[model samples]
Target: MERMALGTEGIAVSRMCLGAMALGGVQDKETSYAILDRFVELGGNFIDTANCYMFWLPDGTGDESEHLLGSWLADRGGREDLVLATKVGRRPSFPGGGLEASEPLTSERIAASLEESLERLGTDYIDLYWSHRDDRGTELEDTVAGFDAAVKAGKARIVGASNHVAWRVERARQVAAATGAAAYTAMQNRYSYLQPRPGVRLPEGGHVHVEPGDIDYVGNTAGTALLAYSSLLSGAYTNPGKPLPEHYRHPGTDARLEVLDAVAAETGASRNQVVLAWLCGHESPIIPLVGVSSLAQLNEAADGLELRLESEQWQRLTEAA
Candidate 1:
């Protein structure tokens, strides 16, 4: 697998980042371990998880994903070979509290959360730590300083902003610069080849759609990368049973899907593969954070990374909407 530099941290990661949102929560232990093993065996080195992963599940306690990854790392015995990333700020302070009652990004909470996440993952340091979501109630300076402290203490090599708009991200970077703290070098948001109608809200809570400004910000900024979540729309592109979400059922979707199908036929690949290839070959160069429950899904995504799109086809896909 090809690797790309993550921000200015001097870290190289796989183009496709495996999202471990369901590793130990919804997915059984045997299936989760098998998926993790196959991902590593395929030369994948980037694995992303969060402290609150799958906590909404009926029997979850918000620690299943990280705990499972820790067990896998212990059994596999190759922690240094992979680029591990986890997040804070989205985990609820108490069980059954929900996302509305999630932890704030204050300095003290950041410190405490880092300690807890480290213990859960059974690692001394995190390659990349992310602010899972923006907390408007908290002072921006406090949040920036907290992440900076993590970098300063060597607990996290670099920091990122997830689910934040471009303007807020810029504001946070300004705060970091003024205070001489660590600025965010990476941006993670919900992005896909087929977009929703403008001004429509996503059904999923805490999901911020990537905007045009985000693309420009990442493209113009030096030493920064964009990690796109929901890049495949939860298998909506190819799965007959998984219909497109209500917000994505506009006319633009039909136009885009037509173009996408044409491209898939031209390349003799699955629709999912074409979408992943388009994302990897995007003008700004997006890293698709894919989550899978089975080995077949993982293998399909791996193959998608190997498929390169022609310039014309890429342009057509981009202009379809």
Candidate 2:
């Protein structure tokens, strides 16, 4: 529950952010509540969710995570006590159960996405709003200008991006510099000890899933922080008894797992802890967003904040993985 300044601004939040992507979708409601409650009890005050969260589930599409999180805020008594960040774009799901036509990033899309998110979250303005994913078709000027308009309208206090490369972030930063608008102050992406490449090949004729290397804190500029989601490798580190899911079972992963095991044993910490804590050693600010389905898992991940790996161990794990 230790706090870190989000971006270079006055917005302060917990070092351990509660990620609600799987909430109300993969995780049952009762269990999700227990996990969230435990996160708060442990002093975590940052919650990150998105409008498009969990719409990928076979059960439903869109807004379940936000609605549930908003309900938690209401129950918790003060929404102002927490720093909330949500995103737009990256809608891979459709209302009728098939992939919809790809959406572009522009003012129209931004306004539509924000309205839906605000409606679902039952809030007037978000503490932080993000572009979610880079829109190759949209001009950075247009996107930054749109966000500037939002800031002027008091729709959001700050804006940022997720899953973007260093150059794209720099481009947006430059646009802000030119216009003197509200600039991106944070980044969120799939960063962790596992799979450092960060890219996924574009589907046949579909949008490319390019890895954003700048998504890492050490590579990010000052005044910006990277929220490392998938911090536990989607339960691979936490659930040792279970084999990794089909998608994560790639070549050289076994070697990475072995390295994680060695680090965990040498440090008397869990593999997830090593991965999460190793991120803290990055040259820039790195905060791992812990996603848990149970309070016990939450406790284990929370204890990870105290785990310190030796420089040798960190190097060995990185090299071996």
List per-candidate RMSD values in Å. Answer: 0.8, 3.1
As for model 1, its CA RMSD to the true structure in angstroms is 0.8
**Which sections of candidate 1 miss by over 4 Å?**
none
lDDT of 1 at 281: 87
Per-residue lDDT, model 1, residue 8, is: 80
| Highest TM-score against the true fold, candidate | 1
| lDDT (Cα, tens digit) per residue for candidate 2, span 1-321 | 567777666888887888888887788778878888888788888888888777667766777898888777677775867778888776653574433444456877887788788877778888889887788788888888888787788888889887777678778989899989989888776667766333445232222222545644335477788777777766876776766655456666778888888888888888878887787766677788778877778898888876777888878876884
lDDT of 1: 0.92
lDDT of 1 by residue, 177-245 (tens): 998999998999999998988998888999999999998898888877889999999988878999998
After superposition, candidate 2 runs with Cα above 4 Å error? 92-94, 97-102, 196-220, 240-242, 245-255
Per-structure clash totals for the candidates: 0, 1
Task: Return the lDDT, model 1, position 200.
Answer: 89
Checking candidate 2 for backbone clashes, the offending pairs are 198-211
Candidate 2 minimal-lDDT segment of 10 residues:
202-211
